[model samples]
Target: MYSKGWIMMELTMNWITLRVRNLEASLDFYHRILGLPVERRFESRGKQIVMLGIEGQPKLELIEGSDPPVKPECGVSVGFEVASLDKAMAELAKEGIPVARGPIAPNPSLRFFYILDPDGFEVQLAEHM
Candidate 1:
């Protein structure tokens, strides 16, 4: 029987894995284009894999594949937070990437913009309002 003293499980995000067509190219894009720092790297079966993470956030695993390039599409994107919305968007512009949206409030307590990643993923660069 369950006891009243039993504590509920807490929700936490430890890490995420992203499948890519090319490990080295994807790693370069993520690190050089997206500017995520590489925290860990590894290999398996002659294939390369790398893990990256943001400042103090959980790691993101990048796995290499041998497939055609994946195209980007709307609604298939991830989100990342930045210190300043305007600054982040401006910086992305230098990479020939444009912000699809501005620092508009998606909901209360937040300001964000949607930036299209290379794979058609919508990356949200957000900040607290």
Candidate 2:
């Protein structure tokens, strides 16, 4: 007999893998600039993929690919919700990393900044009060 009260689970993303041109450079941006830690790294099929973790959260996999996609200029921005916009900007400035857009208080309750990764991908640093 078939069950009538069971709920089916759907497939979900365990990790997000970004195809990048340079694996090491991409990893460094995420680790150094973005402040993500390397959770695990290994190789498969002669290609390398590095997984990054932020605190206790599951991380992203930066994979080396032959033909990297040209990431959209003004769409689907990868936003990193930060603890402090000033702190983040300070750290980035110390490392000689300049934000394309400096920290701005758009309103009384929020602020954000923007920077480009080595591959020219946009990263938005957001803070909420």
Instruction: Give the TM-score of each candidate.
Output: 0.73, 0.78
Q: How well is each residue in 8-117 modelled by candidate 2, as lDDT tens digits?
A: 35544466657788888898899876878888889988888898877566567788877655674735456778888899999998888898876778899999988987
Q: Which candidate is the best by lDDT?
A: 2
Residue 97 deviation, candidate 2, in Å?
1.1
Among residues 3 or more apart in sequence or in different chains, the pairs in candidate 2 whose N, CA or C atoms overlap within 3 Å are: none
| Top of the candidates by TM-score | 2
Off by over 4 Å in 1: 1-11, 54-56, 67-75
Give a tens-digit lDDT track for model 1, residues 1-129.
975553446545767766677677667667897788998888888767888887578877777766544456423566777787778777788878777877688688899888765455567778986
Alpha-carbon local distance difference test for all models = 0.72, 0.79
